[model samples]
Target: MAKFEILSLITSLLAIFVSCLALYRSRKTHSELVEFEKVHVKLSRRQIEEYEAKDAARQKTTLGAKLIDSGGIRLQVSNLGEASAKDIWIRIEDPDSYNPLVSGDYKQKIPYPSLNPGEDFTLTAFIPLSVTQQVYPIALRWLNEDGTQGDFRCTVSR
Candidate 1:
């Protein structure tokens, strides 16, 4: 009878130990999954291109013309993740220095608005000739479809 009582006590403790180990593993797995989800909605700058115009007739002669009367800048923003992003907005940090030709609405906020997984958005603007071969600071803000907000600091070169 005493042997039977001791066996019951040992089995109960073993069961509790197993339950605690399972709980710990469950919590750890949940934490890992949350971190993995964060990587599923990342956004990044994919490309930047600059275009310049030349004086007619001289256009063929001077491929490296310093005098650019008109020019433009193009930027490609891409979502390199598995989830969709929403409420996307972009802002140029120094408008006075770079002088990108932007409308009043754009000055307030260039809204890409939304991007799906593996999707991209191209933003082009006519910029001053002076805005060439320089790096401009930019701010990008967005929200994941799961309501997680994200902000990224980026630079654009033209």
Candidate 2:
């Protein structure tokens, strides 16, 4: 009987020890999970802020081009961007072949001072009847409102 009592006491002590160990492990795991959640939330917020900033800058500048046949082939350059284009310059890749005559000026009358958003300009080009294709390649360079340089190239088709 004495031996049985001693064995029961030992078993009870072992059970208590196991319970304490399990409690300690659970608390440690919870603490680690909370720390990880904090870090993850901070990183997610920073990433969202960076993405929004880039999207805003991207929306600032956009350009659109169109070719119109109004009595003659006219190249219309429009600033469909949210901001204005400053010190805009237009250049024809091969002027001699296309024979572009803009606003009755034999020389290039490009390098307009500035073009506001939604504003546009027309350039007249006189192509010879011999050329089968009605496409003219043009290069455009300009400065943004933030003093950044922008360049674009497109083919004008009649």
TM-score of 2: 0.66
Model 1 vs. true fold: TM:
0.47
Candidate 2 minimal-lDDT segment of 10 residues: 99-108
Q: Candidate 1, which ten residues in sequence have the lowest lDDT sum? A: 58-67
Q: Candidate 2: which stretches are off by over 4 Å?
A: 1-26, 31-35, 38-42, 45-49, 52-60, 103-109, 128-133
List model 2 lDDT by residue over 1-158, tens digit each. 69999999999999999999999999999999999999999999999999998866754565666678788877788998888887777776776656454555523546767788889987776666777767667788888877788888887776
Off by over 4 Å in 1: 1-72, 104-109
What C-alpha lDDT values do all the predictions have? Answer: 0.60, 0.77
* Local lDDT at 37 for model 2: 100
lDDT of 1 by residue, 1-158 (tens): 69999999999999999999999999999999988776653321111111222222212210000112234455567776556667777767676766453566454545666677767765555566655647667776777655667677767665
The alpha-carbon root-mean-square deviation between model 2 and the true structure, to one decimal in Å, is: 4.5
